[model samples]
Target chain A: MRKWSWMTILVAVMLLVSACGSNSSGSQHNKQQSNGGNSGSEAEKQDVTLSFIHWRGEDVEVLDGIIAKFEQEYPYIHVETQVFPSDQYQSTAQAKIADGSVGDVFTVFPGAQFQAIARAGLFTDLTGESFVEHFEPNLIAAGQQDGKQFALPYQLVYNIPIYNVALFEQHQVEVPLDWDSFLAALEVFKQAGLTPIAFPGADIGPGQLMNSMVMNNAPDEDIFVKLEAGEAKLTDEWWVKTLAQFKELNDKGYLQKDAVGAKQDSSIALFVQEQAAILGTGSFHLASNKASNPNLKQGLLAPITVSADEAVYEGIHTTTFMLAVNSKSKHTEEAKLFIEFLSRSDIAAEYANGTGQNVTVKDVEYTSEELQIVSEWTTKHTRFQPRFTISNGEVQKAVTNSIQAVLSGVSAEQAAAEAQAIVEQQIGQ
Target chain B: MKKHLRLLPFILPGLVLYAVLFMYPTISALYYSFTNWDGLSPSYQYVGLQNYVKVSEDIIFRKSLGNNVKFMLTVVLIQTVVSLLLALQIYKKSKLNVFLRALYFLPTILSSVSVGFIWTFIYDSNLGALNKLLQIIGLESLAQNWLGNPGIAIFSIAAVQAWAHIGQMAVLFVAGLQSIPAEIKEAAILDGASQTGLFFRITWPLLAPAAAIVVSYTTIQSFKAFDLVFTMTGGGPNYATEILSTYIYSSAFLNYAFGKAATASVYFLLLIAVITFLQFKLLRTDRVSY
Candidate 1:
């Protein structure tokens, strides 16, 4: 009987321990409240901490500076920033949002993913906010679904071919302006024992590469819109040709043998190390590439024409990243204030200068020479990438997978058809 | 009744925790499996049998299921045989045995993420140590893309999983071997039974219980393999290495198809349950006694 009583006591202690363990958050909240009590009026006035989450862990230093500025501007509001890797961000963010534990302000990818979350009422609609007026109208439209803006672009990125000028000079391969010349240059580089292109054919890389090629032969600006409207399909003649050409690069062994396995970092390393002549990337890599190989001359070029007959390269422009406020946030006002501060022209300029990324703010000038070239491209012949017009990330992912499948021995036609099937299936739904 | 009441408190806490944390989510998943819930949507409609029907028709899901089956069978066979061999080699009491046991178990302590990163470098096509070593050994022709080739990427990943987990199985086997009385083995030796003959006739038969535990564990583990696959190939090279777990994750989070993901998970659980039960039944042997 005494042993039984001891067992009961043991059980009670465990129960108490677990009960206390589960309420640790509650205890912390209470502690915060007690701390607030010490400050009195100042705490009562505006002591609120807002959680800000984004996916770019590599940009933590840049974000830290921006966050510091945000905190200084709004002393009463404390901003806690969390970063997740790009690969895991979507899944992690989705889980957090579903459980109502997401950051007060979170980053969302544009297009179908943004639309899906926004349509589900997961993002606070910033439709008529005054700060929205300062953004480029096109950028604002990118985050809108049926006239309700749920997000705003903070960074503008231009996807083009970033070439190693030294490699080009070493191999005596001219920068190609059209499809034929591109193939010719690739042959020259291959002959010179250099990888023609460092293409990370995994995840979103293949899709971006395909997008770079398709833009060369894009029938018109409305092609993506038509595809979204079900008037055009991935199996269309232009897309099939574009996909074939994309796979041709693989078939010709212009891309490294294991580009399908290598990720962005490894593939980019090839370019930075001068082992590869070209990288299909954006202005984001300019600073890092220059820093890593300071003596290597580098330049960015717009997507080459798909045909020798084409007169000009169709430059591609898209919002790189966007900031959104969680609809279920307890500190909604504070989250919005953080977003507003982050979107300010001066702040955006600072971010642009800090990260060497192009700003999406309506008339902000950047000092980065790489961004200056991107600005010129945007002014000239820029077209919205498929992500901006077609809103389904899964469909885009399917397309990326299909393109990669071609490298794994799947026929170009089959890959294109498969990608089209995904779009069709989504439409059927 | 009063005496039982005293035990109630002891059981109640554990029961409530299990109910809330494990059973509740399981029941919720079962319920969600029947609905067209995107997980983030505030409300969802119960779409009877729709997600299951989609799963049946989905080629990627079928491929993922096949990959998981392949991974399970391969890992179970390889890990079990290798670990049993190691357990036999090091079952004797010796200082060298202790050191080798610890050395073999080192990889099991490392996180799946670290293992994935390490193996990825070893298999890298260009600068990977594996290819470089192959070149150094003048076996360059035999060098292949371990993770890139869709035909063998699943096998490559399975091999890494087996390598990491073989130590645990080896330890389990050693315990089982140690449990068999020395008198039985001495009796067999007295009968002039050779070592291999003794192992086959006695030791193998007695290791059934341990084999059951190991096979069941490995099967469930192989079915639930996600972290290594996620960290390494990301179900890529056209999803050649995608297993059911990674597929379910992608479906739920990436595609925002929670209902489909949940349905697949339920199916996965049922499949694993049936397989594990069959495994225990098949591996069940008459208890060996002196």
Candidate 2:
């Protein structure tokens, strides 16, 4: 009985100590925030910790080098970087923001995902920031919502699919400059018994493909925005044509048999193995592909879906990796400083060369011939990826599903009608 | 009261953990199911069954439910039978039997995501080993796009789920098999009972508890087979492999409709409960006595 009583007493004592420890720890935390190391010794002075979160696991090495440079320049601030896989980043970021533990600086996807975070009132407006002037206006406009620069675009990517220039040269096939020429090029590849385009029909592949497919097909860039507001419908000829483009690819044996099951990795492998002539992805994959197969010469193919005269946009481009300071951040000025440092011409050039990406910051030169080839689009008539303009994921899924449905043997008309019905339901909601 | 008080200190941590982690989320999910929360934002309106009404009308939800039922039935039937048969074949204590059982159980120790990736390579339409092997054997007609075909995608995953868990269920059956009274089996054999007759009359009857356990566990396992489906196919080739858990996740994460996801979760909870209850009743048997 005495032992039991003592054990109970010990348990009570533990609970009391735990409660008291928690209270004092919380108070000490508040005190630390209030002082911010001002009253402490020189070693403790202005030692601010800034959390920077991004989803590019592949860019971690390059980003780490950049962050190290940033820290050396700004010794008073310690930046913690959190990198998540791109697959789960959107949901994870949203959850972090909701739980009030979001990064001091975080990345936002252009258009829909940006609109979502901006709508949540989490973005610290960057319109007045001096770094905002570093980016080209047309490309950086993607990060703006309702005329406010909520985020600043960094990575300037051409959404046009990357094709094998070596394959084209070997087969005496020219780079297709128009719809008719594109069909002729496909015929050349098919006749040679190679897949004209390696199509990854699953996951984000179909959606990414839509950007290039619909570039010249849509009458205007506001078509997706209009669909959201009920001013336009997905059943419109432009949208149907986009779905039909994929159907035509399938029907013509340009893609592999049962291409509907293929994934991005598999298709990329096929391209690297020379089983396919064109990889149906973007410039974002250039660095990885070069690393995978050095002999593989790459070129961009935007697939002009209309006559040269009717084409308004020559290709698709997106300014993504939109960096924004969180509205709830404690070290907003410090976070902004990091973003500003990245905007410096020399630093931006380094990032561009390191990542093999086209940074939106002006005067950043590309050393990679592949990137140099794609960099010409920075001066061309490039349309922003239209699919990103749809702020609703379900609506975006519906539009992308239309293409998938057509690939799976559904008629373009029926797929368009089904997609339009979903649009109507969404607009009604 | 004194006895209970003495136990309080030991139970308190576990009790608090259960309440905080499980009970709190469950209750909160129930509350959110009644609202129009977008998952991330704190602000939301009380919609009062609007989400339920919408999910009922949702075609994808119906399709996913149908897929889940098919997945569950296939996994439960296949896993239960295969594991039980393996248990019967190697239930006796021997060095060879022990090695075989360990080999069978090895896959269970692997993480589902790792297993999903390995199996994904095996199931790939063009580059997969399964198709390659089939073609090499001159059985080209038997080659399939395992994870791609809408008709067989769910079943392909179901087969994986069974294969991944069959060892654990077999181990459980081994214990049950060992527990059967030796005298009863001896008597059945001495009475001129054939091998088949002896198994039906004695061994199977004694294995009721294990079968009940295996069936119940398998039924529940099929419903929560998320990572395998997610990493393998992501419920695609146009939702051919979409099940309840994936559907709910898509509603919350993909669509950002937390209210709809919560409602679906409630439906899923009720579904598992009803199925598990029916399973128990159908497999009910009296506790054996000597």
Return the lDDT, model 1, position B128.
84
Candidate 2's DockQ is 0.38
Candidate 1 residue A252 C-alpha distance from true site, Å: 1.8
What candidate 2 gets wrong by more than 4 Å, as runs, is A1-45, A99-102, A424-429, B285-290
Q: Stretches of candidate 1 above 4 Å error?
A: A1-45, A97-102, A170-172, A220-231, A308-313, A387-390, A420-429, B285-290
Question: Each candidate's interface RMSD, rounded to one decimal?
Answer: 7.1, 6.9
| Sliding window of 10 residues with minimal summed lDDT for model 2 chain B | B281-290
Interface RMSD of 2: 6.9
Docking class for candidate 2: acceptable
Cα lDDT tens digits, model 1, B76-191, are 99999999999999989899999999999999999999999899888887768988999999999978878878888899999999999999999999999999989989999999
* Model 1 per-residue lDDT tens digits across residues A302-355: 547566567444666778578887766666677777888878888888778777
> Which candidate's lDDT is highest?
2
